[model samples]
Target: MPELDSSSMTNPGSKRSNNEDCFLSLPAQDLWMVADGMGGHDAGEVASAIVRDTLAKYPDLPLSESIQRAHQAILDAAANGIGAEGMGSTIVALKHHGENFEIAWVGDSRAYQFTPELGLQALTTDHSYVQMLLESGAINSIDAESHPDKNIITQCLGSQEMETVRVDSLTRPWQPEQWLLLCSDGLTDELSHAEISAILQRYRTPDQATRELVKAALNAGGRDNITVQVIAAPSQPKPSMRAALAHWVPIFTHSRRLDAIIYTLALLVLFALLYWTIF
Candidate 1:
């Protein structure tokens, strides 16, 4: 059996009176999400709150459904902007199923997986202009962080005429002691991978680790709002015999229509077996 736990923390930094970071963790489905808001005006905070609150409405939804709900919520919020101005936010969310985790993201918020042996591996791409510079080889990955346009996101919720958020899923052989880190750009922009690894190494729990890490950013000169959520679960726990007997499926990668098909079929089979066995 694997020991499972997670902890998280957020800070407003020294610059902004209004912190625009929003975070949520649903252990029942092993789901976690974090959003970082932009702040030229109050719109950023408004957009961030809308996304978080909308996602919370589906606390028990399947991963795919929850993500779609969040995406649409952002679209709706964008339509409700103040005057001629626009508002938006960046998001990263994770959902854990039996032996794997599904990830979804938009903008520059990031997701990383850390292991005692493998160090830290980034799972999401920054939807920023610096990313384009790196892709074109105009600058190296090292320079992207300090690039003047590093903060300029190529895509974000509510920015375009027709906005679409990208959802990506990855399945890995789960193991005990593995940790998933989800955070806003604030943490990454101000700190290096080595520095973050050092902080995680020093702290034993998610709470302690996240708190200390945010503190480091503020001390270093917090230029933006910061947020983070951690999701940790044992890699290999023996499946309950009953659960094993009932073959289950996850619909994260499925299209909305197909997801309906798969879940419907699965439910029919489950009820059929129940009627036969019980009677």
Candidate 2:
């Protein structure tokens, strides 16, 4: 199996801990996640950390299952009343499947697939007002920067009942030197795709790429919390066995529904099969 190398960084910006942003990289499973929180006081940080902590607990799930369970975990955390009401966060998660990968996201945090041929293309669209305006042709991409409602996000985890998040999965036979980039609004707001691509090309290591990306945003006047994670697949084997194993470890002792509806459903299906055989 190919091993992934990753690096991440987060900064609070001018505000205190209220606006929390964080990233996690599971090298063994080649999974990476970035979360950006929004809420008054320190609630945002609390919410973001809670989501990350919940996901970090399970590192070894099959990529698709892992992504779904991560979202469910975040929703469960919100429902359990960990923080003040109205607290929510945006997330972008990427998992490697052999030479392929899958992604899941909510709110404005984003994922980017980078290759020398295709350059850098954003994989996730922000659930923000300005994006809607841009899509509607009421405004252009450049105009979105100064739009009055630029910061308004329409969807986020823990904000309402039965929230819908965007989940997308893409896979390609692993290439010699492919990279995956995930980050929050902080980097995109201050830098363009070309700028980001240029920096990535220059930085040899994922750690340096993350650091320089944050430093560039900070130099441009970091007005918000910044979080970034980059994972690059190396052709040779690497040390990610522990993380891969952790991800596969079941987070729950047993499926609560198994003893309830699941068992009943199994019996019903079995009965139908026996009836078909007899009849």
Candidate 3:
């Protein structure tokens, strides 16, 4: 199994005094997640926290099953008056089994894949009103970006109207050096896909990429709680012994002693070739 390097960051943004977004990165368990909460007061924070805690507590469960449980957990919390009524959250979760990976999500929080070849590709489609409009050709991409109802989600966890949350999922082979990005809409709302792709291309490591992305979002006007998780497949293995030797050959040749030895070997090879031709 290829090793995975993961990093995560969450910020309250410039306009928000409190952050209602939460994330989890468990490389050991091959799990990662991001949750964006919604509600009045601190209920959003409570809802997001429940999502994080519930998913963390049930690492052994399947990704879809675990997310369903998280939904039920939030509903239970609201029923018991643990949080304000109507508090809910959007979520995106990822898990890997060797080279194969799965991503499950709800609401508008998103999952994306990045590679040198593909640049940035969205893995999960948004469950937002704007998305519905785009699918129905009622609006174009540019119109959706500034749509008044862009933030209105069609489904999410802990909805009083929903008995069971509808979870969307996808499975794919995770290639080496590819990056998996899970983030709340706060990041997307502030940064365009092209802008995000540029940042990821600029930063080579997950930690650097996550930090820069958050900074860019803030610079672009952070309107909501921003959360991001970047997971990268293991880098290519070290070069072979022959390649390593070739890499050092020029440096070694700069030494007079090694230069003399190399010259001697070349002469000996030439002489052996001549001798073999004569024989």
C-alpha TM-score for every candidate: 0.77, 0.75, 0.86
Q: Cα-based RMSD of the predictions, in order?
A: 13.8, 17.8, 7.1
Encode model 3's per-residue lDDT on 63-155: one tens digit a residue: 889899999999999989998889999999999877689999999999999998779999999998899999999999999989999999999
Tell me the lDDT of candidate 1: 0.75
Using lDDT as the measure, the top candidate is 3
What lDDT does candidate 2 reach at residue 159?
63
What would the per-residue lDDT of candidate 1 be over residues 1-279, giving only the tens digit for each residue?
Answer: 233477767788788888788887767646678988664557777777777776778767765566666656766765665412466778888877667777878788999888777778898888888898899999998898678888898877656564455655556666577778999988888889998888877777887877888998888788778887766756465799755644454554547556656777888999999999999
What are the lDDT figures for the candidates, one per model?
0.75, 0.75, 0.91
The 10-residue segment with the lowest total lDDT in model 3:
244-253
lDDT of 2 by residue, 1-279 (tens): 646778888887654444578777777756788988777666677777766776677777654454455556656765687666677787788877775677777778888877777778787788888888899999998798777788798777666664455554555555667778899888887788899999988878888988999999888777888888888866655559765544544434375433445555666999999999999
**At residue 109, what lDDT does model 2 achieve?**
88
